[model samples]
Target: MAEQTQPADMSRWPLVIAGGFFLIMLAIFVVAFIVLSGEDTGMDADDITETAYMDIVTPLLVDADPERGREHFQRYGCTACHGNQNLAPAVDVMIASAGERRPPMQAVAYIYESIIYPGAFVVPGYQNNMPRTYSDTIDEAHLGDLIAFLSGVEAEPAPEIPEDDPLSIETPSGDDATDADEEFALSADGNVILTPALIREYEDLAEFLLAGANPERGPELVIEYGCSVCHGDLAAGILAAGYAEMGQMAAERRPPLSAAAYLYEAIIYPRRNTVEGWDDNMPDDYAEMISTVDLGDIIAYLLTYADE
Candidate 1:
C-alpha cells in the first residue's frame, strides 16, 4: 500500500486547540474560586470586625433575677394557666415538687425547659395545653428570669374557671395510656425523668438543624434579641417570594458568597463583613447574648425565607 502521509501541522492543531480550551476553563475556575472565597476587604484596618465565635457551652447559667423573672412570668401570661385555680400547677407547686422525680432537682432547669419547650413534660393530672410559642416570644435570658421567679416567688392564685369554661377539665393522669402524658415517666431517683420525651424532641430538632437552618425561628430571634435595632426593620422582614431575590442581592453585594453564608456571617460576625450602604452599628455582643442552639435555630428560621 502506498503510504499517504498525514500532515504534521494538522495533527498538532488538535493538541493546541485542546490546550487552549483547557487553559481558558482553568482560568475561569480560578476566578470563580477567588470570588467565592474572598475574605472581607475594602474596609480600613480598624474598621474590620472579627467573626463572632459561639461557644457550645451548657446553656446560660440559671442565676435568674427573681424580681425580674416574676415580672416576666406575669407579663408573658403565665398567670393565665398556672394561677391558683390549678388549671396548671402554680409556680410554688412546681418548685416544691421539683425533686419528686429521677431527674436532678434542678428546679431552674426544669422550669426553664418548661417555659421554652413546654411539650416535653406535663405535671401529673395536668393537661399539655401550654403554648409552644414562648420560645419564639421570649429570649433565653428572659425565660431564665421566669424560671427564677417561679422558683423563688410564688405565683398569685388563679381564679377558678367556671364549669362551663372549656379549659376547666382536669388533665389525665400519666397512668392513662390513652393520654400523651404517659410519656412523662418518673425516674428511679424520685425526680421527673424528662429525658425520654426531651430526647425525642431533640432528635427532631437535630433533623431540623441539619436540614438546612431554621429560618422560621430566625426572624423571631431577630426580634426577641433586638436584631432589628441595627438591621433596619426586619420586623416585617422578607417573604419566601423575596428569598431568591434577596439571595441574589446578597451574592451581588457580598460578591461570590451565597446568601446563606452571608446571613450566617452577618449574625456571627456582624462587624466582620459590613454590607455596603449599611452602617457598622451591629452589636458584637451576640456571642454572649445568644446560645449556639438558639443562634442556629434563628439562622434556620431566617433562611427559610432568605436562604441561598
Candidate 2:
C-alpha cells in the first residue's frame, strides 16, 4: 500500500530542503559580519559616531578657558610627547611623522585616541611610549577641553599677507616692517594679540573638529586651550584641584551648566553669570579666541567620559 502511494514530486522535496538550509547558513554569515564589524572593537563606526556626537555636544555643558587649557597642556607633561608652541618637532617624534602622512586636521583624532587609550593604535614609526591610559591622570571634562585645544591648534593656518599690499615687503631694518609685525599680532579690538593667520587657522581647525571625521580631536583641543590649569587635569571638577570650595559654591549658585548647551554659553560668553563660589570673571576672550566649531568638538569629547 505504501509503494503504490509514492508522489511524483517527492524527489524535488529533498533538493528544496537542502537549498533552504544553504540559504539560511549564508544569511547568518552575512548578519554576523555586519554585527561584528559595526561593534566598537577598539575603533568601529559606532564608536566613531558616539565620539562625534559627544564632540558636538559636551563643550556646551562645561566651560573651557583656552588660556587655562593651554597651561594644562604643560602641567600634564603633554608637551613632552606632543611638542612645544609650534607643534613642529613633536615631543613624540615618531608619531609626528606618522601624523604628517594624514592632514593635520585628521591627526587630531589620532591624538585624542592616544590620550585616552594610547595603545589602541600604535603609529608604525612611533615607540609605544604614550601612557597606557589617562583614566587616572585626567578626568572626562578636562579631557574634552584638552581635545578642544589640540583640534584648534591643528586648525590654525599660516598667516597670509596680501602680495599687493605695500607693507607686505617692508624690510625689518626699517620701522615699517616692525610696525607691521606688531600690528599683525593685534586683534581688531586690540584685546588679543593673535595674528590674522592664526585666527584663520583657528577657524579652520574649529570647522574640521566639528565635521565628525575625527571625534577624538575634540578632546585634544580642550587640552590645548589650557583649561586644565584652573579646572584640573581633566575638567572632572575644579574642586579636586584646589577649587573645591568654589566648585561647590558654583554648583549651588549657578543654573548647572554641565552639558553641551551650558558649556557653549560659557565659552562664548564666559562672564554671563557667576557660579556660587566661583568668580564671575571667567576669561572674556574665549568668545574671541574660540570658534563655534571647536566649542562643539569640546562638547563632544566631554560626553564620552563625563560623570553621570
Candidate 3:
C-alpha cells in the first residue's frame, strides 16, 4: 500500500472547511443587513433621481399658491418640525438664510434643492437630518404651493388635496371609532389637532401596548392570528402589504392617526379605507380575539421593520 498516506493538500482540509463555514456565516449576515436596511421610506439623500431633476418645477413654481402652501404646511405634518418646535427653521427664515448659504443659486432654487435633497446644503447650524424625499411623499403640483409659501409670495385660490390630507382623520363609523377618537379633537378646519396630549392619549389607549412591544413577537402573531393567511407570502392577498411591512407603513398609511392608532384602527375598523383592489375582506372580529395588550404588542412588533 506504498505508505498509504493522505496527499499534502489534505493537511489544509480543516482550514478550508473553517474558511467555507466563515464565508457562509458572512453571507448570511450580509443578507440580514440588506433585508433589515432595505425598508425604503424614500427619504434618503440617495433617493434623489434624475426624474426629480427632470420634473418641471416651473409649472408648479410659476403657479405656486401661498395660501395652499400655508394649508399644506399643516396638512403634511410639516409643522411637526418647522412649527414653534423649530426643529427646522421658519419658512421666512429659510428663505433668507438659503440665499446667503448658497449664493448665485437663487434662494428659491436652493429652497427646492433643500426640500427634495436636504443633504445638498445644510442650514448654517442645523443638523442635516431633514428627509430628502419630500417630492416623492407630496403631490407634484403642491411643490410650487410649498415653494410659494416658503418664499412668502402672494396667494391664489388653493386646490383640493390631490391625496389624503395628513391632518384629517377618517375611520369607519362604529363603536370602535368612538373609543378611538374620544381623546382627539378636530380644528375648525376639520383637521385633527395633534398635541402632546396625543402622546399621552396613545399611551393610555389600552393594555396591549404597542409603545413598548417586543417586536420579535410580531411575526409569530401574524402567523398565529391568521394575518398570514392573506398578507403572508404564501397567501393570495390584496393590499400587498405583508404583515411585518405593514407595521413599518402603519404611520403613513393613515395620517393624523399615530402608527399605534392606525394599526389599531386598521385591525378593528377594516371596513374603512377598503383597499382598491379588494372588498373589505379583513375580519372585523380580530379585536375580539387579540387582547388590547397583544394588539399593542403586535403593532410594536410590526414597526420593528420600520427604519429608524
Q: Stretches of candidate 2 above 4 Å error?
A: 1-62, 83-108, 153-308
**How high is each candidate's TM-score?**
0.32, 0.29, 0.40
Task: List candidate 1 segments past 4 Å from native.
Answer: 1-59, 153-308
Residue 28 alpha-carbon offset, candidate 3, angstroms: 45
User: How far in Å is the alpha carbon of 105 misplaced in model 1?
Assistant: 5.2
Show the lowest summed lDDT stretch of 10 residues, model 1: 49-58
Q: Top model by lDDT, which number?
A: 3
Which ten contiguous residues of candidate 2 have the minimum total lDDT? 169-178
Candidate lDDT scores, in order, read 0.50, 0.47, 0.60
Candidate order, lDDT descending:
3, 1, 2
For residue 9, model 1's alpha carbon misses the true position, in angstroms, by 27
Pairs that collide in candidate 3 are 207-293, 208-292, 208-293, 210-296, 215-301
Residue 24 miss distance in model 3 (angstroms) = 50
In model 1, the Cα lDDT at residue 175 comes to 34
> What overall lDDT, based on C-alpha atoms, would model 2 receive against the true structure?
0.47
Best by TM-score: 3
Deviation in Å, model 1, residue 179 alpha carbon: 42
